[model samples]
Target: MIEYLIGIAFCLSSALTVLILLLPSQYDPATKDKPSVQILVLGDIGRSPRMQYHALSIAKHGGEVVIIGYKESDPHPDVVSNPKITIIPLRPHPAILQTSNKLLFTIYGPLKVLFQIAYLWKCLAYTAPPSRWLLVQNPPSIPTLAVASISCFLRQTRLVIDWHNFGYSILALKLGQNHPLVKLSIWYEKTFCKSTSAHLCVTDAMGLVLKNDFALQAPILPLHDRPASHFHPITNPQERNEFLNGFPETESVRSSLAAGTLRVLVSSTSWTPDEDFSILIDALVQYSELAAAQPELPEILAVITGKGPQKKMYLEKIAALEVAGQLQKVTVRTAWLTVPDYARLLASASLGVSLHTSSSGVDLPMKVVDMFGAGLPVVGWNRFEAWSELVTEGVNGLGFGSATELTERLIELFGDDKKLETLRVGAQKESTRRWDDEWDPIVGKLLGLT
Candidate 1:
């Protein structure tokens, strides 16, 4: 009887030991496992404010973000700063492959996507799984995208894509709509949108376009590409004077620069005829005498910053209008800004301008958001839903149908100090409220770290 009892005890102990070994000791059922999220931001790192905002938000949220970026003229902050972020630089993919990728991205895209699949396979095998993965809209590289898809499958990870711009629409505009490239881009967008967990767009209009055209069930999140505050406002009277001194004007012009002058600032990387900056210039001219009538009119300066395709032509236009004397008063600064510096410089301006001639509705411009953040109002065309949703005419800012209307409105806004102050305060309030309520929440949700 004693021997049998000993044998039963030994067997029970062995069984309990085996069960303990099978269970994961490291796993605690009650604790929420911190998901390992690895995001690959593949794009022109500096050019798009959306990319910057997305990457930074993810990093700030405590995710491991890696950037595979291409260098343009400016160096991006996410590439250099943020301890959580790592950047992998590569040579610009050949334009031919880019073209071919667009071609294959459609019906046959998956066929060519094998290269990306193989690349992703290797990446996943090395990195191991259960990590969340993503690829933001970028150079439109089919291979990299393929890799993302394959990596997600192999690793059993969730995949998300932030499609900032409609590459197909851009191609159709730049190239003909009937162009093969346009057709292919549309096709790739469809497939990619269908495959991803979510596709983030910059505007509601764009999201509508995707859903209506592709019939994609993928969830769409509207995320405008804009920098977080880049520069501190130069409110100090002394600092403003020093900056003005750097771009000195004659006493006549200096007197033209008055304190209350509704200063209009226009800056961009490049200006094509499509931008139609002449509208702003003409408006400045119309309000010039009126603004001059006020003590602030002398301070009413129109500063056009950055080099663009229209640089020479616009310079000629400035000269012809005799705004050249005003151009000296107008600060045409070169495009040299860290993201933060650019934001600060923009905040100092009274108004943000989105003067695109193309009728294709306003994709939410980063300038608008930056303007919002800085408490500056936007003077934009009224065709865009985004403009309507954000700006209330004569409230937050004014949107117009034509150059004449835009100019007339500018005259009214700048002429009245009470109205201008009202708009400025409203703009700052609206910007802060929108950032906290709308954009930041969306960013938090997208990161899945909310």
Candidate 2:
């Protein structure tokens, strides 16, 4: 069945390639002054920050950007207000595709890909303005890669793929590596990705993998994720208090904070399968036990923010722990905040926790980058090889392998004020390195903006 769909996609792409060769090139007088670039994302535009950053950077360099993606959440104000940037939202997947039943998923997966291909083609080839380049995100690589490649060929646009992680590797997490679906995804990604004009990856290790493993012929540059100027430390006590007070969720912990008996620990998650919230929950449970026995230990208010599938399940687990009288000195609260508010939360918090253990092991988590941007030191999962690149062992942040290790790191940081301060100072130093500093030189040249 998957083979049938693949054959159909191939036929469509071949037909489009021949048709485009026969058609006259499109020239718009209005886009003559600005070099147009289309940023394609198969996921939500607001949630995909790296692509948004790419759009922003392109616009800054006087390139007109058309962002094509699902607009489920509101994007950053800067992106919304940019005159040179235009957003073309794609049709969302059907509600039935959101089902958890394996049978339903297996049946509808191909249908979802077909729907995505048609819509993506329409948006890329017809609706969006003709552009010099089309930059796309990977990991939804199946139909997205095929559609973008076809459309770029049809429109006479350069195809640039920004590799976050291997899409096949992510799929392998749900289906075993030996699964036929996983194999198909691997073949699809490798086949289409080879045709990209240029490649931008999240980590240098990823770039190496592309060259060594995939044998990609394109110029691959590792453009690491860095926070925008909007993400900064909230130094003013009044500003911090005001932001925290604005949220009703933080009300219960305010008095404890004022009394200097509680500390705020912030963790931002998509509540996805890749991030194991169980580790965090276990660590928090252990912390609660320790804090109950030691009166001098600080009470914790853990603020976990983001929307995803596993959120309700984890929330229920946390609730059950509370009901059973297990979590006494620790409180866990979940929230979905605006971009600005999220930055404020990170800045105001005493520490940050990252649950992301990369699916591909070569990619670094952008959440940790955001946390560092807000001058909050992170206790990230350290199993991946790429973790060391962004997080230094004793400098900016600490790392943990298991729940026990995480709990121990938490105890050490929270118990010793001086050690936490040193890490915070390191994180503040990291905050100074903004996105544009790295983006302009490499990415600008790739897009012919430099």
**Candidate 2 on 1-450: residue-level lDDT in tens?**
999999999999999999867543553535667678989999989999999999999999899999999999999889999999999999998887777666676778888888888788778777886888889999789898998887777677889999999999988877778989999998899899987899999999999999998999989999999998879998787888778777777788888887888888999899888999999999999999999998888999899988888899999999999999888999898888889889999998889999999999999889999998999888999999899889988999999999999999989999998999899999999999989999989999887788
Angstrom error of the Cα, residue 221, model 1: value is 2.5
Candidate 1 accuracy as TM-score: 0.71
**lDDT of prediction 2:** 0.89
lDDT of each: 0.58, 0.89
Number of the predicted model whose TM-score against the real structure is largest: 2
Residue 152 displacement (Å), model 2:
1.1
Question: What TM-score, over all chains together, does every model reach?
Answer: 0.71, 0.94
